[model samples]
Target chain A: MNNNILEDLELFNEIIKEFLNEEKTTPASKFISPENIMKEIDLKLDKHPLDNEKYKKLLKQLINSTPKSSSKHFFNQLYGGRHSKAVLGDLLAVILNTSMATFKIAGPQVIVEKTILETISNLVGYSNESGGTFPTGGSMSNFMSVVMARDKIDLSINKRGMSKTLIAYTSDCSHYSIAKNASFAGIGRENVRYILSNNRGQIDIISLEKEIKKDIDRGLTPFYLNATAGTTVLGAFDPVKKLVNICKRYKIWLHLDGAFGGSVIFSKNLKNLVEGIENVDSFCFNAHKTLGAPLSTSVLLVKKKKYLYKSFDNDAQYLYQTHNKDY
Target chain B: MNNNILEDLELFNEIIKEFLNEEKTTPASKFISPENIMKEIDLKLDKHPLDNEKYKKLLKQLINSTPKSSSKHFFNQLYGGRHSKAVLGDLLAVILNTSMATFKIAGPQVIVEKTILETISNLVGYSNESGGTFPTGGSMSNFMSVVMARDKIDLSINKRGMSKTLIAYTSDCSHYSIAKNASFAGIGRENVRYILSNNRGQIDIISLEKEIKKDIDRGLTPFYLNATAGTTVLGAFDPVKKLVNICKRYKIWLHLDGAFGGSVIFSKNLKNLVEGIENVDSFCFNAHKTLGAPLSTSVLLVKKKKYLYKSFDNDAQYLYQTHNKDY
Candidate 1:
């Protein structure tokens, strides 16, 4: 097995070097249709393992045919291009293959994740009482915020079903995950009020306040207000400072979805994009987007750390052997 | 940037070669206390980038101190030891760095994921209507099942809040994610009835039926029945064949969580462990667990593919640029 790993790594080096060279010249690899995919590359998994030579050849073909998102010409989504250092870190993670759920099992790797969360928390101007976790993606991060908000507004909602018509607010310009998350959280898609956005794609505060007042008139309990740090289409940052006052007036949990442009916090000039981030109840930003980290490196931070534990904590004797809080 | 990537790859090769040698000699990496982690390795992230030499040295120190999960002597989690081929594939994925959300962006990679899902669907005896998606992990897979079941039982549950008193049944020995998912789905954790397990660690069917009947008698709806393929502690397979009939009589959605040992279906000798799996509403297993792939390669398959779309299909014009169904 050791020899096999070394030999494969050698093959990987050769193929990646060739692929990188091609990326420099062509940038975008030739796109193969779905129907012609099987002909272009052998993707079949068989009962028996193939020889090293055959396996390496097939792998080279597959890698050559894959889309070159790292190429300079490729610009389809929010994430593009690979950072060399970040890629190296990801490759090491694959080699280590450790689960970060428990401290005893993951060891220093847990600290590695914690350091990232802590740094991001501080960058958002959160106090020592703040805490965060890396969810799977931007969608999951948004979903976690909704769940936490729902539980915080009505503690019995987790143990007992929602007794009141709980409402949530987000701009129409926000990511589509808000509606999906609303349905997933059993709040119902109809319960989510999508306030209209202005021409610049920022949330219309007047319209938002009107909708909240309307819901309140109907005897509905409004809980969460999802502000967008970076709207998906226009790349607009909502008026966070203005929205903070509105959220406070309504006593709503304010969550900022910065999946598209949250890395502005790292930039001196762009920091003003999310000026009132410190006052928000929770904030999430995808490191993979602007930071050039690997895909799905989303960070979710909560002002008061206990909400994360309250919403996600579940006791399993077999898995969580240790009783440490940090883990 | 190209030169930097090549240099980093070279550094990666050297460090990995040394790491592999250490694994062969001493499989378990040295453990460092959380308190001493900062002193042991330079984990701090700063504003300025370090020089290549210093950066590489720090990376080497960090990787050396990290837990050796892939080593032969490591027996901490169910996922131990790494497949060299899978590692190669993961490294290639990192290099490609494509988002798998849409066809235009992902291209042939979509076909690769489809092939794996199709094969798994067939292995579980799913018909042409069957389909699957690679969720982030086993916990997310189970959560999807709950959400799907919730939406399927009452179609209005998605657009409107859950109006009925819906109850779900699971074994006491099942994964802890069941309760967490229930709370996330707004089903209420108390609504998930934990049927006691027998001495063999399989769910007691008699108690399960009694709970179902009692829920129905109290004007409550029994919507989901989660049967464990392999109980986390004892590795016991529940009587799936018998539970199918009970689910059918109650019209409950039967979901099999094979996160721990669902790969038994791949073994001809052990295939009988998950007998009558074809009748299940949904099934999920972790390829990363028994299959020796990367950490979070979980596959969720449904008997009727439309349920997946019904629960998770949120249209984003900016994302799904193409209208093809296969994407």
Candidate 2:
């Protein structure tokens, strides 16, 4: 709005145009040396190190980043394909800066996240009672699924205290996240039993069943099982239907770690991969992955509604309670 | 592009505007029934049972999505703020669908993410060997740090196998995710010893020293000691400088979990809270939290760059090796 700001904007436009022209002549990345690039840029814009807050300094910073995770050059993990539309939604989201913890601040994102979860639920064949939340990613989703399992099967654990002797099961080939989830949720890693896996990376239901029995024989309470839809090392799908049957019979809480492949529901061809998902207590996947959202758009859909509360219901006086005057 | 398309665009624009306007009218914490909200949207969108086809159905979905996370009165977790510019970048990222594993697929994003990492490095005061990556969230960041510690302290453990005698240390007030990380990384929860916390909720350093001595006396391998910054429940900060010294003297890998408070680097007031962060083998934080990036934009910066490969260099021939040729 000021004359100085107007002058700066005009100068900025000219310098940007000059840089674009030079880049068109020789791709910006070709000029490797920081000094050379700086010198070249200086010819277009007035170089004054004294003006530390100038746009050129910021522009220089915008150019020289290494490792380049977003640049297609930095592929270290799964879910690398970034989504522009999803990114836009996230941009809109941050500007809005609303939390999903309540009914109002998260107006549209709440509906969007909820609807997306519902879409996923329909794909997974959950009933009207099924619901979910947009956690940071698949890892957090798995964490929630584990907590839900622990809470449902051992409802008294939170109040009476964790049964240190309790045990849970997942396949050897499944993600290592589940073990961590159990440890964090107060189950202690000692209680989490790893069931052996088949050569194809599927959970050996027989082995899992035997482990549960063995743990019970050892006088440990058996509570939960996490069936992976796809393992990180190998794209492995667990025998979800078979695993669910065993859990149902044994009264263990069953949930699916479908973060990588849960989006397979979108592909009719891949839908069969998660056949027993409908039978599980909960399921989750990353939209940032196969579903094409920005990183962190992960969802956890539950078959039973009450379990989510059992896991994350922090009854702080300032929040969650219905008595807040601001609310 | 066409009159039909134009008409549809107008309808979409009108609908989104109306939705935004209506959103401003809603009261926070009034407890709007999910069913009633869903019904109202259904009335607005008027989904015809007869409509068929995947693409159109997905369009209907876009129309129905909750647009803003903040507008819904949601704030359950730490990193719900969805940034607009970053989201725009993300959408462009998804549409282009570049694999960041290599420069050939994700040239621009790789450049962008690399720059982002560098900015983080400068903040943490790591000049040369400092390195990091954008993992899913705090849990994975913790998981990777554990993996790095395990590989750095004991290489044979990876090739030979995990020893039951190995142990890790964190405060009783630390995030649940840390215990999970230890267990998932194969140390087992039994090996993760929880140190007692003082009244202000800092990790008891004297107790930590005692436990490490006890573990060493018993011939157990004490590999990792995690000092948390911004603990979950109490938002507590550990004494990083002391922990770093102890870790250095005992040859233990020290990690700082600043996933929540790492962004305090930008604040002159809070930066000193993590005074000795540079001495630790690794440190991690989520930009999605304090930096306002969408979920899962977590960065794990390590003191020794080589440790990064030791932890996550598990990429096989098909998925990663081929992409290596691009850069």
Candidate 3:
């Protein structure tokens, strides 16, 4: 090993020891205000470089001050805890510094990601025609699903700019990303119909079907419907079976925003939460949540592989010259 | 340090040493076929668990076969090299695993990302009104810029699907992501007018203006124009000052696709390449490129902060309860 790496390894060891032992034990550290932490540490970058001793001290300070999301006491965020294996995988990826845009540059790393997506697709009961991608987070995954539905509804939307008042339906209790994703897809926030939820905070199928018919009666297109596997507050799973039926009847593209609770697919007992997930056009879940992976390990699986290409595939000659069909 | 972490650290060091000493010194390793690598190691995940001894050995084999992009001989991709500090930062980020979405959850880490973005924004000569985000990659950054421009042209596009024939312009030699972004923004791929380039691979300003005028005469709304800071093939810098004038006259949103070459903002000698970048509505560049950060450290800056909110902001009550204006 190089001398510099040895020194870094030692320093990192010290930092990790402190983070795990000192920070992880305290609940008060989890609520440290950003302003309060900034007062204690100089985060401001200056013109001159700090000496080795000072740099090490600053790094230690940063590790000390940063919120301890991996700690047992840290529970402010939707994603908590960390897996050593997943962290090792993430660290190796950083050291390799490869982009997953193409197979030529990424090599086996592409297969690693593909394997994970494939496993999740199979768990969701999708067949060989299904595929997925690891978006940055749950929001991007949800947003991409909306884009695919929009394009699928009208292939001309990509060319002509919105010509119709297309409506999207979601449980009023679903994650806020649904409305945000609708906005990103050029489907206005007003157009995203927030159907009334039951006492369980799950989407009321009666309200959803009624709203779909209401939109159709108003001469507007009812194009998309979202079913949440785990809601933000109540952790309720929408009636995917009933929603799938409504989607089939109205020809609306059905999507399951399983970003929070979709990991239930891994459990034989809990898989019933999203029983009709196989019928949905697209499904997404974050491995960071429920499962103990690193944050942002979001997976978006589509029933039809064609939607993945139609939504995101762009021909960049310089980057994708290898163009293998297997990729 | 924990016993498990110490063991894993030792294993990681061995893998890194082998990668640097053996893999980094050769060119053939850079071109290792995916199939060949698969033959050397098992990638498929099975239900059975491997013992610690077997698991560690398998991991070593996997690491040995994986392509080492950090190697000096590997230069097939646009991003090359790795900064030790960046790698260290990324490793720490993985261990902490904090989401960048909100201040409450992210805490001090949010400030770190914000500080980096603020520094880059100032480097591009953006004012107090300027704001930025670290998108997942060059394409998402470019796509976000298109979304901003689309919304700026007509806020109603988000509410009602495409009703206008809005036209966007970019040099024929620009990055492929621009055309893809247009399609994503519901501005059809056919509508993205590819202005002919000069022999130097720079946008022909005359052809651009003529195309803009022609599109206007044909009753198409000329709303957006992208000036490439570095053409993909020839590395040509477009005449930003000239394009800015046409954009101002036509009331079009001017975006600088500096994904490859925007790092020049840090070089006094080469900053002249994008001299008129300050006038553009938005600019993007990847720190993973010339600056040698980890892969996907792309930066996107917009002239006005409202456009960022208009394009992306969606309210989620559970997540953004501490709605701080600083973000």
Q: Using TM-score as the measure, which candidate wins?
A: 1
Tens-place lDDT digits, model 1, residues B139-192: 999999999999999878888876667899999999889888888888899999
Tell me which residue pairs clash in candidate 1: none
Q: How well does candidate 1 score on lDDT at residue A274?
A: 95
Residue B150's lDDT within candidate 3 is 86
lDDT of predicted model 1: 0.87
Q: Write the per-residue lDDT of candidate 1 for residues A137-235, one digit (tens) a residue.
A: 999999999999999998788987765688999998899999999899999999999999999999999999999999999999999999998888789
Better of 1 and 3 by DockQ: 1
lDDT tens digits, residues B261-298, model 2?
77777788999999988788889888777765654478
Better of 2 and 3 by lDDT: 3
User: Candidate 2 chain B, which ten residues in sequence have the lowest lDDT sum?
Assistant: B1-10
Model 3 TM-score on a 0 to 1 scale? 0.95
Off by over 4 Å in 2: A1-94, A97-123, A126-327, B1-99, B151-162, B180-201, B217-221, B230-237, B267-270, B292-296, B321-327
The candidate 3 chain A region of ten consecutive residues with least summed lDDT is A1-10
Q: Rank the candidates by TM-score, best first.
A: 1, 3, 2
Give each prediction's root-mean-square deviation over alpha carbons: 1.7, 8.8, 2.5
Which pairs of residues collide in model 3? A158-B188, A159-B188, A161-B162, A162-B161, A162-B162, A162-B163, A163-B161, A163-B162, A188-B158
Task: Report the poorest 10 consecutive residues by lDDT, candidate 3 chain B.
Answer: B1-10
- Sorted by lDDT, highest first, which candidate order results? 1, 3, 2
lDDT of 3 by residue, B231-281 (tens): 777888998888889999999999998888878898999999998888999
TM-score of each: 0.97, 0.60, 0.95
